[model samples]
Target: MSSELLHDSGLIANPASTATLSDADADSLIAELALRGRAAQRVLAGMGEQVKADALRHAAAALRAAAPRVLAENARDLDKGRANGLAPAMLDRLKLDDARLDSIASALEAVANLPDPVGQVIDQRTVPTGLELSRVRVPIGLIGIIYESRPNVTADAAALCLRSGNAVLLRGGTEAVHSNHAIHAALVAGLEQAGVPADVVQLLPTQDRAAVGGMLRAAGLIDMIVPRGGKGLVARVQADARVPVLAHLDGICHTYVHSAADPVMARSVTLNAKMRRTGICGAMETLLIDASFPEASSVVAGLIDAGCELRGDARAQAIDPRIGKASAEDWDTEYLDSILSVAVVDGPEAALAHIARHSSGHTDAIITGDAAAAERFLTEVDSAIVMVNASTQFADGGEFGLGAEIGIATGRLHARGPVALEGLTTYKWQVRGTGQARA
Candidate 1:
């Protein structure tokens, strides 16, 4: 599409050099979005949970049926990503196959089975004066998502937002532009075929950084901005966005082995945390072991056996002489690769202290047989998601029974953990009174 067409239609301002929408265009789009969102909210609020579930099941089936066409378009994105010198990790994220498509569809079906989080009153009360008050779950109106090269996010985010009755405007990374567009098209088709508003789920239609800038400047147009990517992207969005942004920053997650940790459980959990899809944000970047623990050496050796390249401090290197000396920068790094940084601390206190100083406050885990230490870490650690015996990979919403997730929220305000259906909504006061005066 030409810049003139995009700018003239008020969907974007310039499509040539920057492909960004202007303030005027953003306002127009947002107004339309709000209308659609309100309409969806009304329709969904009155809908039975079973009917909503049926729509979701139908959408999932449609996605499976459209796999061949989707994969064909996805290959174009993968080729483009490679031609543009994108990282192998990013290219892998952009690529899609029938299996991945089926997974996405299965995820949709899972979400359909989850209890609807909308319009459910969380709490209710009646005052002595006979005034009734209730806190209910309601759609957040409109949301703007800025994400990276994951095409599954396109379907997952759309499904979660639609199920919650919120309209979303997604701006996926340029590497998966073609794939994202195709997936969004399929989702829109599914929604329309189900008699839902197509505008409830929309894409930015371009792959320009300036378009992200335009989205950031869209203050009144967008209700909230949810960014799902690296630290650099999250920092930029948080700094420049005019709207309230839900930050899903880097996952500098940690797994600390307490003195009382069972060696067998610790070894298995730590290896899985670091090696199972190291490219994912929830993957462990650092491993902390108690200096007093007798089995620390064997645990470090186990990690190495799992194909993890060990980078450690002097203390760690002394225990595992094969490890390279870890640099100062390694402590704070989220090495989304095969490398794992190992450190030896005095006890649970020291481990928690180290994590509090360097963690991204995303997900952290403690492998311990002692109930006291586990309770301490669970209470003291300020991360959004903390685990006792599970791997950090369990930070995902799907694992938490939300079916799918837009992303993992590292922020601590309105939404903290997973961006599920409830996370897509905001509560509002609904008041009804007869002709009664306050006085």
Candidate 2:
């Protein structure tokens, strides 16, 4: 295909194209992209909600229509990843198949169908000064998303940003370079067909690591930086970014089984949480079992039987001789694999204490028949998401019914938990006053 195919506008003329640029050139390129993104953002913010929705729907259709191309490109990325000795867990995150493509398209369609959050009145009243006061939702304007190994993010993040009336600059990982190129082309084609500005969703043309630094330093141009990856990436973004960061830090998620928990639910939730696509951040890494629970031994055995490697403390090892001794570091590790850290807590207090010390504040779950215990856990666990009797795997924006997530925010700020379209927005207070001054 010709690079001129998408060259009509600044919509990533060629995503697979890269250059060995000096630091000066990279900074210049990022600044130019940011300026273009801001221009497109203004146009999108003024568009009717229905118009934006239509464009996203078109994008979804385009993605489906281009499935063959997308899948082929994904295969190329997978081959390179295998050749480079990428870890198994990361390879899974990078790989894309027909079913996953369908899911990605479906998520785009779902975001289109969601209620447009832009311009909605969050609060309204007549103030004492005779001014009509209202707080209305507005886009966060020109967001830069830095993510790794997840090609689907190229679609999901763009859809959510457009739906919320913001422009986005995507800097995807090199591991999924070919896949990102194919996906971005389809999405841009659909948006352009529906009369949206091509620059509304821009992708960096190159995969150079220096471009990431340019994005990090783009404070005025990019309103916010959202980092969606492992702890290392998030930590770097948090440390180096001049732009405000809504960080998705380590998903050191925990699942606690109280003594009153049913054996069947404990087994089922634990197995699924750890084993069902363990590469995701929401996958449970720590299992806190109440020592007094009658089926504690069975729970540990079941995990090991399912090929999950368990690292546990002395007490946990007592439950199962097969369990390996957990190092102190194991308590805080975010193992995005079929490995788990287990702790045998004497009671709810012990479990809570362990979670408090080690939890990454992503998502924590409690399994119990006792309402009091469940309620207390919900109240006390200060993570972005707290669950009751559900797999931590369900800690997803799509699962929570917002179509798809831009990212799961582990921070305690404007956008926490599963960051969907609504989370991509902030609010501005509007006051309608007629010749009314301050008293």
Candidate 3:
């Protein structure tokens, strides 16, 4: 189906005034999308696992078939972004090639292959009153996702939500509007082919910022809001959204090299943690070394040699004259680039102290061979994900074997870490009783 047909079919709102939309118009559009989404979610909830899996597999095939068109749309966005002087990192996230399209499709297929999370019995037992009580997973109903750049999120978020039996409403950034529309069309075509409701996944058809406010204020319609973008976007959604939010905040992650860490292992893991696709949220932003560790210089030298710009505290700077001075703010910054902040700590306690002060509670890693120190670090760090003897870059949904993620949630409430199919679901109690009375 064409993007226009999808818009007209009520899968998406009609393209609104891009320049400005009155509060009433924006509210009407948001309401229309939400109503459609709720209806779609009801249909999706009734679908069996096989039916949903077939739809995802069909969507994967459609994405592969529509690769050329998707790439073309992405190119147009890239050109405009360049003209608008988007940063290199932002452009990297915005740009999509054939390989990325293929990966997105593959991720959808992977999600289909995983066992469906909906309807799964979490726990069941018989109460003393002869009441059978059980909790079964269910969809969160209509989910509103507001993201920036990374057009692939259109497909990933849709696939995860559909597989988990929830409807999704996507609001992608203006930078990738064309790409998002193109991808959404392909997904809708797949849904149609599989005999599923196309409205199961819809994109807001306008780029006006007001659309976001509408989604945020959609209270009863949008069950939850997942913001996948920069700190500013996440902050706005968290601050203004009336709906519950699954926030993806800054990845000011830290990699601490304890005194027991192997020098070679530390060098290898640190390089990959910082330089392996530095634009991703899993990338390590800060490096901590125990002052008692004798091999800190080797690891520092390896990073500098690998073309990673190092901004270090006074002690770290004293370790290497070539290391640039890092301000207090640098420790808290998420430089989604080739830059890294370095610090030297007294020991595991000091490292923990530093991380507690500056870490974003996203992902923090400790590289140590000492079992006790590793355990201590793991227990002490309050981040959603903490790694011991592993690179912080492994903090990913796909790497964690959950297929693809909507985003890595930093919040400690209902869900944390990589939000995959299971994260999309909430549970409800089912009580069965022949005869029961409250005494």
Candidate 4:
């Protein structure tokens, strides 16, 4: 598409000349964008549910229609990433194919189909002094999302925010700049088609890291910030952002095999959890085995047979001669690769302690048939998602039936796990009084 087309679609302001701009210039640009975002948010918050949902549906269709251009832009980013010597795992997250594009489009449609959270009554009550009161969902105003590599997030974040009656400002990683711009253009087209202000979703024009600092400092303009990437990016946003943040921390997830775990089930779940697309945040990084479990050796061998490199403690090493010795750091690492850390614990309590000490509080799973043990693990793990007899890989927004996720939050308070439509909202008190003055 031409520059004029993009501008008309409200995807860009002036796509002309800015190859060398100073940090101050980038900050000025971000500030300008934030002002536009705030204005758009006011318009969005008042929109009817059908209007927002229609916008999301149009955006989904636009993605399918613009697939060729989006793929062409993605190829440029992929070529650049390879040239930069990006790791295989990072490349997996960066790459986008036709099927993945279709999936992204489907996710948008699903979000559109979900019930709109805006203006929904959360609770209702009648006061003793005859006053009607209610808590109702409301938009969170403008949201700033800083993510890495995943160009799909550009679409997902925009759809979720728009459907929840919030405006969004997206800042994707430099590696996926071309892909982000292309996808964003399509989304803006959809918004315009549905009569929604295209400014409801904006992408930072430049890939300069300084723009991140600008967003972090936009305390008054942006309501909340979401950082969706590795530990370094999340740590920086959590530490420096002046605005309230919905932080997505490390996914040092674990899968524990209790003594009552069936060997066949344990083996199957562990393999799928660790090997099914290891690049995602939900991929299991550590494996905990009950020391007295008879099938520990079998489960360990199953993972090794599935092409996973095992770094094990002394007890686990004793079970398998080929298992490499795990360093102290292995337990706490989020290896978004084909690596797994193995440890042997006494039982449920020991497993819980190990996880409590090393877990990133993201997602953890237990493979056991015992009801009491499963309940204890579920209750005591202290992670955002605790699965029973299931693969940790199932720790996804789609799997949880939220359609798509901005990111998996490991933080306490506000939001935890997959942050979808409801997670993007805050509430307000709505009271109806018949001109009665309180004493």
lDDT of 3 at 153: 95
Put down candidate 4 lDDT per residue, 293-390, tens digits, no spaces.
Answer: 89988898888988899999999999999899999999989999999999999998899999989999999999998999998888888999999999
**Candidate 3: minimum summed lDDT over ten consecutive residues — where?**
8-17
Per-model TM values vs. the true structure: 0.91, 0.96, 0.96, 0.95
Considering only N, C-alpha and C atoms within 3 Å, which residue pairs clash in candidate 3?
Answer: none
Question: Model 2: per-residue lDDT, tens digit, 6-117?
Answer: 3543335456555555676667778888999999999997899889999999999999999999999999999999999999999999988889999999989899999999
For candidate 4, what is the lDDT?
Answer: 0.89
Report clashes for each candidate as comma-separated counts: 1, 0, 0, 0
Question: Residue by residue across 284-339, what tens digits does model 3's lDDT show?
Answer: 99999999889888999999998899999899999889899998889989999999
lDDT (CA) per prediction? 0.81, 0.91, 0.91, 0.89
Residue 136's lDDT in candidate 3: 99
Clashing pairs in 4: none
Would you list the rank order by lDDT, best first?
3, 2, 4, 1
Better of 2 and 4 by TM-score: 2
- Looking at candidate 4, the ten consecutive residues that score lowest on lDDT are 9-18
**Candidate 3 lDDT (Cα, whole model)?**
0.91
